[model samples]
Target: MGSPGRSHRRLPQAPDRKTSIQEAALLPISRRQALALGGAALLAGSAGDARAASPQGQLTWAVHVSLAPTWFDPAETPGMITPFMLLYALHDAMVKPMPGQTAAPCLADAWKMAPDGLSYEFTVRKDVTFHNGEPVTAEDVKFSFERYRGTSASVMKERVAAVETPDARTVRFVLKKPWPDFLTFYSSATGAGWIVPKKYIQQVGEEGFKKAPIGAGPYKFVSFTPGVELVFEAFEGYWRKLPSVKRLVLKVIPEESTRLAALKRGEVDIAYSIRGELAEELQRTPGFTLKPVVIQGTFWLYFPEQWDPKSPWHDLRVREAAALAMDYKSINEALTLGYSRVANSIIPDSFEFFWKPPPAVYDPRQAKALLAAAGFRNGFDAGDYYCDASYANLAEAVLNNLQEVGIRVKLRPLERAAFFSAYAEKKLKNIIQAASGAFGNAATRLDAFVMKGGTYAYGHYDDLEALFAEQAVELDQKKRTELLHKIQRLVHERVIYAPIWQLAFINGQGKRVRESALGLIEGHAYSAPYEDVTINTG
Candidate 1:
């Protein structure tokens, strides 16, 4: 598939007055979406975007989604973007994502693989110290790895035969097989990379640790109010350069207008997840700057019930028809403001092993023909199309497109927690408009989303499972790359899921804040290396 070029559109002029904050929150879509349609024109005519020219002091960030203590624990964290926002602030991994690179040294200063590829050794950084004044040791690394009970833990347990510490500052992992993506697997972008103090957790217990978490990251957890706010202070004892901001406050502002209003009023240093006309307004306005990043993920449709042969979705023709109904270009223009690209396969284009198939062609006539051949010419009720409220606009757009090709679905919006919980409990029915942002190569993504017994997968295919298993242990880079390509081709040919487009996150920053280091790392959606970020004083 051909790569799509970036496009820009001028923001329409703002009106004289702003809508009431209360009214703005109740809109069908986000305040940014409403702003794109001229509902909140006050943002356009507002004052200049400039702010106090300083990089120091407290940095208050207004996040678009709410967070809870459930997400703070690295061991229990489910794969999602919101939780990682706090995780990045309060924790450090053995290896972290370097600026523009996927993996770099962190707690583990250096690492090497054995000649046989089954055993890997890491030389732990001796200077690293936790927030509580205790030096990080190899035992802490072993404990943290064993304590992990998250979605990826099963994969780790299956692949890792043992975690051995030869010395206080040296740790080694003996794998059952030669996993080709071991470095990416243990990178900070995933849960396995996060290291915690074993002594502290043992003394405080899991519940107690969540309330007052301690880590060896640049920031130390001060306090947390579930679903509302979290506070962190710069860790002076950090091995790396200390964070410029003395205090960091992550305020959970679910409403888009509230976040924007906070940024406009200079109440917050940064506001995340701003999109559509609001992003454009920030770009045109003087005091605010819009930072757009294309994350490595795709907003696609999943048919959980399709695994059952009785369901219409079980038919490939029906699934292909559903995929064909989506107009990727139109959806990208409407929702992303032309900032996103149409996804050609499950693996995002950013990955090294990403396979670019033919670009998706929108053809309602062909889609109708497929559906008719599958015995649904007039379209069948697909039941509720459930998704998190954050994706309301995208879900509605998909529903409209599907309706045009005779695949009817009603939008059922749920709170973020409820939406994720439903999927975790395997209660999701009919079609689900969901997304996956796992950071790694194509093999990592395919294993997590499509392989048998995968955390996010519901369907099972023995042949595909065999291929994935083979690729996971294949040491030859060329052979592994070819295997990954084959898996992507199978996913595309089977239409396992209807991939829509790759979504980009738009962040609004007050001019006072110069976030030079804040950007996607290994396609991480919530990456913010606070230690490197400064609130520009000039």
Candidate 2:
């Protein structure tokens, strides 16, 4: 009946023995249990919260983590912070952003397109070297892509045919079609993470590659303690100058309170992703550092096309009604600690050309009316899949709001891994929410969200699939802009998915920790370049 807050625990689970990426309860629980798992938010409704430093030479960096990385292979999982580290360090790409936010220049020094717009050529930097000290050749670029083609995770394979290395320093990508953001999607901040050392990767299988990734990054692997720690020392021979900080250490601590407590006690250098409730407390405890960079990202809603027929959401009206009935204003204010702004498109406003925010019209009566029109005047029951404790709090508020609208909705809270898998398989009830994008440009953001094989978006919608393909390689600005707008509108009309907000987390950085491997970028996590980062023990 009332909103509540929880602490240090997952929301209660259903008695049934069922688990999936996004697990549903064998049966929904009473309201009281929901609050417990959301911590403060589940209990009340709103909630809370990387990497190591360099080791080589003289500096040692220490970064605190709240959880073990879900995965370490960037080529495979974009969501894993461990793999993100590899993306910048061991591999090089066609394009990367110049540090201090200048032009794009990561791996490829320069590139050009054919007159027909179908083929794009990138010239690799002459001096770059991989972690194993192999001269980066054009074939390695081709190898990286050839590997990408075998998987469903990447969209690049569909449009690109092959890589041709005319010489040691030149790698040219021949695209099946001309794409405006194709270069950016793969090389820019939005696309291809660095290439892995090919021969070594083949030598060691997927599992070995994850453990000891040898990248040309500023830092190199030192030691890993599984769920507890992973350390890397500086690579002075990095293409860039020696990093100011040296060794970087990643410390894993899954509980939020323990992490915040570690920061206050000066035991951990950073409580990386801060939970919302402990934020005020952490800030109150002096010597804590706050770096509030505007992240280019958004929270995404996942609406499955088909749900169980007997569920309340079996009707489209119920689905649309829940969307309209959700009160984001209250949830944002109460749950996010006022750190985020409402997002319009999957792209963050930080981008150069984010589309205009669509008119936000919130009407619970209309939501109910829609349900009534769809034949549920008396209301029905369903579930909301919460990916985390913090979101569970926000979801509970949404569930609370839906209750007000006469729709009896239950909050189904899950651990992050299972939650993601459930949504990916489209097995959850027709709706769920997740953080989405912050690509540097309109093209990159839209492609990541609507692109055929994007991590966040479901690729089933044919019109969306067609629009994304055309928008990517389309050379004309006028036509590209029009297509982007059409795609956004089309997604809105379908109402299967929508944008919530671009968010920044309140983080706890240690007083003793100095920067080594912690390179901040557009979004959260270790997805940015890890060079020039150093950790100091002195």
Candidate 3:
């Protein structure tokens, strides 16, 4: 398989073909369409003799962000794509994302929902053992869920009434009410699905565990140098096939040019988040491969104090004017090379429940009129526009567009850890550029970013909050979908956020790498099923 052009290709099947057809159906194309699009060829290439005969080698992956120990701890996880880069390697979840499917059973062998939809029972796999040689038990599952302190903890606390371990192998979760998306929430796509060794954590304590963590993932933790690199070795006792690559090194190379140089010089096997002209250049290069995957995220602008009447953003006219000021077409062409789609709503257009609002009008005249009506004829300074280094280009583009409309914004870029820490602590005071590619349906995205008291939420509306709460417990799918549509409409009508475009991630892979699967879903950015990846030695 080579780098795809304008179109997307179906992901190859995982080494373990345990995924269900229902899960595979959730992808953009049907299974038949997938097979027609060279899926069989890809599958055969992944499991062929070449991969089997390849000798185990060390695979060095270069990432743009600096990783920290906090990303490895399941309890303190921030539930974003970046953290999962470490989480997927250091820890194993009860349910994990299948190669081309929604989710597949991992530590948990089977699960069933109650007739009333208020409880879920999972059959824990008895054969599974953590890296420390401790058997994974139902008690451990219960403890992991209870000890979660991440952003998703609010959803868990509100929905999960109690956890019961009837026996060593059976674990049940009693819900506060009927929730249709309960399974998706607990899937590997989110933080709630991660399972940790309870006994080990209690013995070492949370802080100590961060320093040296133990989990049931395919790779065992070797060592970590903060802001530098993380090393891991294949776990011989892993439940699945041992990783084909014996050693894995994740190096923190924040500079894109340096990472590209490392890839060309064979210092790194994989380089992540390659964009703009560099991505196009890498695609044409002989030895390098450019892999582009559509993520379930958007590059958009957020107003932190939009709800405060004292702030200029409190006026709906001003927000609408700001939205109109954005030149999405130019932004998409410049930033994404015309690969990304302009977003109409928070939910991507590809999703079934997506509300197709009209494309944003780029009417500078109307925007100026609206601004003048809102008492800012010569648009006021909108404070600083905060974003991580990775999104500096997009932020700069947004800044220029706002400047055209007379809204002055100072660009402020921070490192990955600092950016997220500030965002979580609600320290961002101005228009901020943010992205979220989390898996799950529209409701999951809404709950995570827009709902009242959400992790990244800066504004709240009581009516929308009540509707979200109602939709959570509504058993009927039709009624729940209707409520979700209403919420999306309200958000767009009120200009809650200035939706820009749905982003596609670009990655560069070297010739030495083979049999690698970069997940089938949108949120699988920077995460891969490493055990199945084979390093070519020829």
Candidate 4:
């Protein structure tokens, strides 16, 4: 399939029942359906007409989080999907998840996996060039992979024995063993496959590169004001298509009200992460589009203290009680305006080899009993509940529920980056409302959160780790699926996590915007395919 321009309107298949988030949460896409969602390759035939289209206007975004320089560099991806917002504009990936497809070809025109599953090769697009006019080659791909120090880097490096540049346009990856999720990890899940200019990075040191990063994407970096905004200009020579908007500006607006105000006053073309009353107001207001993007991200309560034998959370009854205490349905209705799907597991239902667990049972009485059984008849001090500051409201709601069930905790909200940093460093204690919006299937999710030595994992279980290891090398699809499902079942049965729900992020678009690229990519919360974004000047 050819690379889709702004006019491309094909969307992924939705749940059979359109009734509610609760009803839809029970239905899981079959393995066949999940496999069918594989992305398409871009054809040069589509590029001619797309490149010929003249660029115009400017698009501004009132982003919910503060802009970080780390996001500008794909090699430093935090293992989450948020960085993709900037990476999509400033850089291009060999294989990327696009609208209507999960692993669409971008920098690499075509790629093939060896029959033995030990090697993979990609044919780089010859027409592709960085913003600095340097052609992307196999060497650059190798260099980028070698230099990747982001999330999952250690595992990627361990699994891949060598990266070979057979020709200028051909890059081959020879794995130490048959790792089935190689593409999912390298391409869709992490930024390891996102190509950067080899010659330019070598010339400019890492810090200098961050100051003025360049790429082969549709938009080129123009200027950046720390904690204020980022500016970009369209790169006409982009391999995919010339960006419809000539200028792109991303302004940091941490407050939801301020973002909404900016959108209402026409200060910004798009505003992200509008929730609760603000979201409702946006939906009711005229001349505005309130888009609820059903992202692949799932919010869950993580008990870092659970692994500690001396901690109260270590008791099975305590963990079970926490899971039972959550009123997820009410939270979904109140916060997401009933648009978010109530999740039973962190692994998204749309992913390959997904196992749909039973619907969550909200039983406050049972929760109280479990706490009593665990020797906490009058409740226990669960210390602080750490969460992303932007989702403090959700955390507050969770805390309220936990309070009622005798699992008392204080709310400790931190900035997004700070929270991740603290969590990664294992400095955080007590409860953590964690989430993952990164792309990939179930095994990848387990590797990061459940398996030992993961980027964000606090602890691991021996049995689950064994299962994970077994699935990693299992070449048979049927056997692998069974092993993965068993692992998820173990997690569910043990109540390792108190799942909240799959997020349905609310965003606003102004009347000036024609195509915001909102909901263009399945499970991506932000407006994307920045090249396809257009405006209505008339």
Best by TM-score: 4
Clashing pairs in 4: none
In lDDT terms, which candidate is top?
Answer: 4
Ten residues in a row with the worst lDDT in model 2? Answer: 40-49
lDDT of each: 0.74, 0.55, 0.75, 0.83
lDDT by residue for model 4 (1-538), tens:
1221112222222322233223323323223223223324122234545345688888899999888888889898875778989998899998788765676667876666666678878888767899999899999999999999888888899999999998999898999998878888887888999999989988998988999998888899999998899999999888777788999999999999999999999999999999888999998899999989888898898888788899999999998898999998898988889998886898887778789999998999999999999999999999999999989999999899999999999999998888888887889999999898888889888887878988788888999989999999886778999999999999999888888899998899999999999988888878888987998977
- Write candidate 3's Cα lDDT for 48-140 as tens digits: 233233226789999888887888887776636677777767777776554544555567655666766778788776588899899999998
For each candidate in turn, the TM-score is 0.87, 0.78, 0.89, 0.92
Ranking by lDDT: 4, 3, 1, 2
Which order, best to worst by TM-score?
A: 4, 3, 1, 2
Tell me the lDDT of model 1 at 160.
Answer: 94
lDDT for each residue of candidate 1 in 29-90, tens digit (9 for 90 to 100): 22222232232232222212333233258888887766767677888766555666777778
Model 4 scores a C-alpha lDDT of 0.83
User: Can you tell me which runs of candidate 2 are displaced by over 4 Å?
Assistant: 1-70, 79-86, 89-92, 98-103, 149-154, 189-193, 306-316, 359-362, 384-391, 406-418, 438-462, 513-520, 523-528, 534-538
lDDT (Cα, tens digit) per residue for candidate 2, span 427-504? 666457565432346655555455556554554568777886777666566777788778767666655555566666
Model 3 misplaced stretches (Cα beyond 4 Å): 1-55, 350-352, 519-523
